[model samples]
Target: MSTFGDIFGAMRQVILTQARLDQLDVRMTRMAGDIDGLADGISLLRDRISRLEGIIEGAAMAASRQQRRIEE
Candidate 1:
């Protein structure tokens, strides 16, 4: 035979569990969004760096050609 007080305590515990679960869900959502933003930023930086590398390599190749001509 459960008393009224015991029933009230059980309900309070169930409510607390639900509240904590909701908080976790919100935190996970924010974290997922932040991770996506970071990934996008990283991809943009990679593209810029690849372009810069190509430019630097072209300049180096042109300089080498000039040096070879001078040597000849």
Candidate 2:
């Protein structure tokens, strides 16, 4: 009878452990998706910043050209 009880207890523990693992898997999957979305957002931000930098460089060049003409 004692052996039977031990076996049943072990089975119960295993079931609980399996359930926890499954829950963890679901959470990990969701976290991965969230990370992917964040990466995409960061990429978009980087692209916009690059575009802005280009625009600023162009403006600076124009200003310099204008200044040189004025000096002439």
Candidate 3:
């Protein structure tokens, strides 16, 4: 048989556990948003890097042509 004090103590623990779970849910939501922002940032960086690679490839080709002409 449970005493009143014992039941109250169990209820208190349950409330505290629920509160902690709610806090974790909020933090997880925020972390998900942050991850989405990071993904967007990474996508932008990938696009910029691809453009830079194209520019570098064009410059290399131009340099190679000039070298060939010089060697002729």
- Best candidate, lDDT: 2
- TM-score to true structure, per model: 0.86, 0.92, 0.94
Task: Write the residue-wise lDDT of candidate 3 on 1-72 in tens digits.
Answer: 579889999999999999999999999999999999999999999999999999999999999999999999
Q: At residue 32, what lDDT does model 3 achieve?
A: 100
Report, for every candidate in turn, its global Cα lDDT versus the true structure: 0.99, 1.00, 0.99
TM-score of structure candidate 2: 0.92
Error of 3 at 48 (Å): 0.6
Stretch of 10 with least lDDT, candidate 3: 1-10
Q: What is the per-residue lDDT of model 2 for residues 1-72, given as tens digits with 9 covering 90 to 100?
A: 999999999999999999999999999999999999999999999999999999999999999999999999
- Write the number of the candidate with greater TM-score, choosing between 2 and 3: 3
| TM-score, candidate number 3 | 0.94
* CA-RMSD of model 3: 1.5
Q: Number of the top candidate by TM-score?
A: 3
**What lDDT tens digits, residue by residue, belong to model 1 across residues 1-72?**
468889999999999999999999999999999999999999999999999999999999999999999999
Candidate RMSDs in Å, in order, are 1.8, 1.0, 1.5
